[model samples]
Target: MDIRFDGKVAIVTGAARGIGYVCAEMLVESGAKVAIVDILADTLAEAVETLGKKGTVKGYQLDLTKVEDIAPTVSKIREEMGEIDVLIQVAGILAGNPAEKITVAEWDKVMNVNSRSVFFMMQAVTGQSMIPRKSGSIVNFASIAGIRGMKEPLCSAHYSASKGAVVQLTQQGAVEWAKHDIRVNAVAPGGVLTNAMKSAPPEMLKNAIEPIPLKRLSKPEDIAAGVCFLASDVAANMITGQTLIIDGGGAVVGV
Candidate 1:
């Protein structure tokens, strides 16, 4: 299928690196004018520069932790990139403390960044752009940890909770926005092979990857492909309020 986003404008969060960066690159290559959003100004610049060569791309530095910043930043994006046709919320944080050990502050921080901000950004974008046009696509980041919980040296109770919320948020958005022609979905990645994983202890990495039916970690591009498919009208016009699990078949083994 010729999956192209010829005239679409996409806003991707956490585009400074990892899954978000790959998603932005793919969208641009597919012909969308993409506005990359991240808090890391320097890295965001590098991403824009790298992807700019492929197609129309720009960067905006916005801290998702602060929910207050979501609307204005989205307005700025619409002003600059035109009405948003797609929104991929890949911006998230990880808190690895055990459930009992996790402090209230830590819990709030994780929830704010991983779940709350995603909703507000979607609300802002939908209100300002998508709702008016009555057409758009929204893809969010959920996680296997959220579904099955984490069981490794690093405790991810808070992260799991936040991602669980993200799954529900995506579903709620899809249900409420369907009449407006906005499709909402999510991508759940497991043990992705990113820079962060490369620095992890060998044992930790092994424990993480051994159970996968594929016997491998997911690449950033692997997750990006799911995001792009959900964002592409030609590919996912009828898909909404669902999650595509890109976990190297880890879910099949109940990992």
Candidate 2:
């Protein structure tokens, strides 16, 4: 692949496992120093052990949902490791039920973890470093469900709406940050295999896939690869405020 990030530093949130872990591994292998941030305290330590072989890897166990936690965590990384060149947001939550059955607590939890954290984390990272440098990239992990209503809605109204918010948030952030030379883009993925996916019920899974053109689920690496492209200047030089749909062309139908 002609891409090499020999002198860059990256932050991959929710890196304890799944796509976030994969993103961190990919970035480090491509020659960028990476910090793996996750709320899973024990698992974060294990991720560092595996991902630290290439370049440099730092492990941070922080709950991104805490409004005040992101800034200081980012500050600590910057204080010790110089500036971050890339920030990949992969933390997310999904709880699906009929809208009528979805409780307020469920809705709030999904929005706060999946959508709200992205906003604050972006503010902290860009606020403290990227914006001023006028050169950095932010890759958000939005979902295909964000672009359109799920063909088979497994999640309640809130999950889809929260992802939709991420899509617009990416656009807004991109537009506002472009002048700072920072790029913000999102990878809206189709059904990807992850720890989270295993929790879905058979009926919910069936509904989620019937409309996908590919007729098959997406791989975590598939989504991670797209995220890496967006984070790298080589692939997304002129791209910003755009949501790259990696959905097996599902959006072609109605999305």
User: What's every prediction's RMSD, in angstroms?
Assistant: 1.1, 2.0
Model 1 quality (TM-score): 0.97
Residue 196 error, candidate 2, Å = 4.8
TM-score of each: 0.97, 0.92
Candidate 1 segments exceeding 4 Å error: none
Give the per-residue lDDT digits (tens) of candidate 1, residues 110-164. Answer: 9999999999999999999999999999999999877875776555888998899
Model 2 lDDT tens row, 1-255: 566677998999988899899888888888899988899998999989888766699998888778788899999999877898999999887666877888888888889988999999999999999988889999998887777666445546888888999999999999999999999999988778677787878786776678878886778888888888889898789999999998777778763
lDDT of 2 at 160: 87
Clashing pairs in 2: none
Angstrom error of the Cα, residue 207, model 1: value is: 2.3
